[model samples]
Target: MAVIIKPFSLTVEDYLKQEEKAIDKSEWIQGKIIKMAGASANHNRLTLNLSRLLPLERGEQNYEIFVSDMRLWIEESQSYVYPDVMVIQGEPEFTDSQQMAVTNPCFIAEILSPSTAGFDKSQKFTLYRSIPQLQEYLLIDQKSYRVELYRKVGERQWLFTEFIGKDAIVELEIVNIQIAFSELYKRVKF
Candidate 1:
């Protein structure tokens, strides 16, 4: 996350065009473009841990891994977000010719931070559900070894599961992958 602000609202097209040229990253929520918050060292470590291990669990041939640099656009919510970790089962649906913004993500993970935890759990999760291809959302806690997984079971229905402690295993049923809790929190100071 980076700190860059715009005083006005930007349309989807406008956001995409400007975001490409911008030095740092920002998100488009509804019609407003907001600056992204900075991530702590622990947050960065957790994101890297998962990003590095997911390819092995999900298979490099089947899933493509993306960290926060790539943008995910939810058409229904009219949002553009940079998730901590994202896995696409197959080809991604790009929002524009530039291929800078993605539309379809089978799984997404966000690192929890004091400044953004509430938004990630409530408002951001609400918007992410709008994507038909999204099957699971992982919220990884940077303060402790905890993960909250929300698996989509049916239309408008989601099942909640939690994994806590270092030895716990986080199961991603949608992708048939499992990750040890300790691996995700590796090198995290908190």
Candidate 2:
């Protein structure tokens, strides 16, 4: 006979309290707590490259960029996620008084991984769309020079753009920034 254990669920409050002291990060979706896996070398490199390339201040507009450590709260789905990179045009809105999780992000970028690529493109993207302040979403392929951009064109419409090859450039319309594939993939092995 095989032995099996049933999965347990945690409330939003319980999950937040536990996550505060946990060594590793985990995501809260509905009532389930999903542990986040460690990022790969290529993923880290891509994240760093993009973060450094984003200007802190473009003209009179000030922007705040956060790496992987910051948490993003999706109110519609009642979930929390840690994106690879998040860009806020102005001040960020926190979920609570603790200021641990942010609610508003104008631009978000995620480096695709073998394990989470599908989710990132589908379910995760759905949750991100619920954010009223989000304007652009970027998905970067760590294994190759490929990038996808989804820009909000209307209240319920989004424009999709894809860039391929090493010489291609990614244009972030919301922030008015452009980055070349070579620069974004710098120091990345694949």
Per TM-score, the best of the predicted structures is: 2
Runs of candidate 2 with Cα error greater than 4 angstroms are 1-6
Please write out the lDDT profile of model 1 over residues 108-180, one tens digit for every residue. Answer: 9999887788888998899999989999999998888788999999999999998888899998876786898
Candidate 1 matches the true fold with a TM-score of 0.91
Best of the candidates, lDDT: 2
lDDT of 2 by residue, 84-129 (tens): 9999988888888888889889999999998888888997899999
List clashing residue pairs in candidate 1: none
TM-score of each: 0.91, 0.94
Model 1 — which ten-residue stretch has the worst lDDT?
55-64
